[model samples]
Target: MTPTDPFPRVFIGFDPREDVAVNVLTDSMQRHASAPVQIAQIRLSQLRSVYTRPHNPLQSTEFSFSRFLVPWLCGYEGWALFIDADMLCLGDLAELWALRDDRYAVQVVKHQHDCESGTKFQGMPQTPYRRKNWSSVMLFNCGRCKALTPQVVNTASGLELHQFQWLEDGEIGELPPQWNVLVGVQDVPEDARILHYTLGGPWFDDCQTMPRSELWTQARQALNHPLALQASS
Candidate 1:
């Protein structure tokens, strides 16, 4: 979890409903990463002991609030990346990992997302708030993010956490928007490194037609068809 850490540690939010999404995402990351990466899924069911907060009605995904636990999970030391399950890596993750900055407590793609209020995948309400999708992807400088203890994460209001009230404004660094291109929400960019299916993904019947969904389908196909190994003398 430090600069000396052998591989970049990535913690992905996991929701049981989108199990396939996480699998495909992992496959995409593994295929594109220039070096080995350590990935973990943050499942609420597995953290019953540490995260005991009652579910909030507005919670869209199981990892809504649990995403804040990334720093604490890293033992409040080193650097790590946290991303939503509904994402695909189109470019090498090593490129994204190289952008980590130590000056900020956390780095994210600062988005001014003003999407209309409506329902998203699986009938989830699309609520709007300040710094809406920023938390969806994070590069945590865990050493500087000591403020996010387990108690703070579990007890803090959604706004306080999502808006990053735990740290000063200057401490919140920014990443390029292309790293978290929102499908159907943000304009499709030719160099989008990570495609975020924040609204929904092709895995769901209704979201099958989302922009660049074919890319996700292709990744899934690649996941299912592993390269065959040839026998050697």
Candidate 2:
């Protein structure tokens, strides 16, 4: 948590199909966040009017444009964090939250990841693109992201946002890759802060065993455990 605020606002991309996955990620974050956490879902249906540009459905997922709406949703005020719902938090988010730098428009795990190959969850084709996983976990310097207004997010070309063409190189700051450990694409470090099931997770029948799948499986197991529920109550 920041010194001035007791509750941090976090927004996660939401897709109806991934409700359970989102819940696990939320539970993991709340368990570790030091202060009370406020989590909001970014839904495309609600953001449609905000986008003023054409979008290509073939190349998009449920979360494709939602991530870009963080600053707008916050009314371009104080800082806010946006993370994909597929993530599993392993460390206190306050740590990630504290890394915010006001100089840049956004701070992300600057992964030089090649676009993912092979099939994605439920057989979604994995297409490669620049700045591949960079937007998965972000600390939006909302005040600096003024250009990413509702109209821009609604209509900007996918490449402009995903490739980060929206901002100059200096405007982007790098975060430790551990904050977004890509399960299959990269090696998991001893102190990974978050585990991202970029491809798929155990919840899907086809992805019951991706790299670090055990972590997610264990998280779900903990969520389902009666003892865990009793403890929370």
Candidate 3:
């Protein structure tokens, strides 16, 4: 399919607290994507039937486990991408879209980050779990991820999905690290494709000085978010 084809879908998590971050990320994607991208923000609060049930012990201030529902959300069709809300796209997503491999159930940047020292935004413990932050960005081969049904996402332990316990490690594929570059932990090359603000984001007052914060500010300005514009001033 063409990069501009309406086939490859993208799903991003949304939290009310980071509302502006989500908007800026979306704007960046739309601006650089070659095709008419189909994007959806997975809002936990709006998913009554799904979120109301107790899923797992894993904690998150944002969409949390809702990300695992991507394959099911897309009706298990073709490939779909899922990214955290606190991310900025600097390159055409179509490049990543073009890398979809039918051989694996899912593909992600294989991160070996050891972020045990810091806490997530608002003081949530940054517990270092297995395959940590790997799922922060993913390309789900929906047809291949048949195990991720609505029931599975609703009941599976956080470890089960995040660690990819369902499939053999061999079933997972790797993408270029540039596709999910962590803000401070990684050396972001001049041509990094995607910048992930894993620690926190400029939306939080203290994160204004973090790596790539300036880029995020520019993206926000491009989107014309009033609060971010005023904050930048």
Candidate 4:
């Protein structure tokens, strides 16, 4: 936690060269978080001895590993939650953090869509290769999971990450579905809080999906609060 109360510092990865994604994330942080949201933007470095691979196949993020490593570099020694920019938070967030337990360095819950429909990853049946929960979001314990980072980095470098073939081991628990609701408009319930654009983004100026837009609105409420954006110093 930064000296500003108990709120964990939040970080996002971006290249200022691309302003739109950075702007989208910056706007979301202020709109959603209960406390001050700290945003960090990292540029690829020429520094030597960088972690080049991933330990867990699931965590091989093209741009996210470096972002995930920032807190550690700053001497932070607690757990950190990493979310996709497309994710929007609804309801109180403390519950997710409180769900952390001793055995797992992370907590994940089965995906609701896959869990209920019996349809599996990519809308297929569950098999040995596919995880019920496709990683839209994740939480990590710096103290407990730090050892896994080097391995994650290694696997990242070992393979062609551009294809996004890596994912973390499934042993970690799933985050509740409430934290990762997708853009299911017209058919979804009224209280759904998050709207993950798992398949398509509403960013297109010509987007015409109302249900998806409603979902985006909900996400913006949590992630794009106008007040929160103005509060950033």
Model 1: per-residue Cα lDDT over 109-211, one tens digit each: 9999987788999899898999999999999989898888889888999999999999999999999998899999878899999999999999998899889
Instruction: List, residue by residue over 185-212, the lDDT tens digit for candidate 4.
Output: 2244455445555433455343436345
- Can you rank all candidates by TM-score, best first? 1, 3, 2, 4
**Residue-level lDDT tens digits of model 2 in 1-233:** 34544456799998777788899999999988887788998887777766444546444358877689898888888888899888899988878877877788899988887874656888877878788888888888888888887777777777788878888999999998889999887888989989998888777888887888888878887887564445555
RMSD of each: 2.9, 3.7, 4.6, 8.2
Tens-place lDDT digits, model 3, residues 93-212: 888888887789999999997756456766766778778888999999888888987788778887887899878899899999889999888788998988998888899987888887
| Model 4 local distance difference test score | 0.48
- Residue 108 displacement in candidate 4 (angstroms): 2.6
| Candidate whose lDDT is highest | 1
Query: Which ten-residue region of model 2 has the weakest summed lDDT?
Result: 51-60
TM-scores, in order shown? 0.94, 0.89, 0.90, 0.59
In model 3, what is the error at residue 206, expressed in angstroms? 2.1
Residue 111, candidate 4: C-alpha displacement in angstroms = 2.0
Report lDDT per candidate. 0.91, 0.82, 0.84, 0.48
Ranked by lDDT, top first: 1, 3, 2, 4
